[model samples]
Target: MLRSHDKCVVYIKSDDGEKVVDEIKTFQDAHWVSSPKALWRIYEFNLTEMQPAIINLQLHLPGKQAVCYWKKQNLQSIVESDFVHQTMLTEYFKMCPIDIEARTYLY
Candidate 1:
């Protein structure tokens, strides 16, 4: 089955990184970056629907600027992006064949 949820990362930056991090926790999960380059993987909303919230990241942070990175993705691409996850996922696939087809079944 096709995964309908979109993915994104919200970068919240501030002179007060700690405060920003704490304040940011008030928001929903699966939307903020996990790395230093300001990555946020937000699955709370689909691509077009999430644009406004991503834009608001800039306004939401205190005494700093923010950014958002959004990418359309599939299971393979998501797993491939992370090395450790990729390794484990590759192993899992070797042991158990994925019932989901690699691509959409279409004309």
Candidate 2:
């Protein structure tokens, strides 16, 4: 999209007046109708292609993991729940002590 000695003229409008600027840069507007990516987005097509993908692993200390509850739920009951105390990190720690296979892997 760019070539040597190529420059673009931009006109900016403000409360004061219109100002003209000359700059050499790459400008892309995905929301514009002229953009192919905009058409793909409008048709609900895949926008990105990634290899292996991405994953989120939650790590927290004991009794410090996140908990989801409704407004009507009692805080005391939620704190006492078994699921509230367990997290992926805590489970891994528990498994490493009992399962010899788990001890072989690094955290």
Best model per lDDT: 2
Counted clashes in each candidate structure: 10, 0
| Alpha carbon lDDT of each predicted model | 0.38, 0.66
Instruction: Give the runs in model 1 whose Cα sits over 4 Å from its true position.
Output: 1-7, 16-107
Per-residue lDDT tens digits for candidate 1, residues 2-104, read 1223434345568767424433443354343435323333433342454223321112232222322347646565444544233322443444545555223
C-alpha positional error of residue 4 in candidate 1 after TM-score superposition, expressed in Å: 11
Score residue 5 of candidate 2 by CA lDDT.
33
How well does candidate 1 match the true structure, expressed as C-alpha RMSD?
A: 19.7
* Candidate number of the best TM-score: 2
The residue pairs that clash in candidate 1, if any, are 8-40, 8-41, 8-42, 9-40, 10-40, 30-42, 31-42, 32-40, 33-39, 33-40
Q: Which stretches of candidate 2 lie over 4 Å from their true place?
A: 1-56
lDDT of model 1 at residue 62? 29
Candidate 2 vs. true structure, TM-score: 0.44
Listing every candidate in turn, what is its Cα RMSD in Å to the true structure after a full C-alpha superposition? Answer: 19.7, 11.1
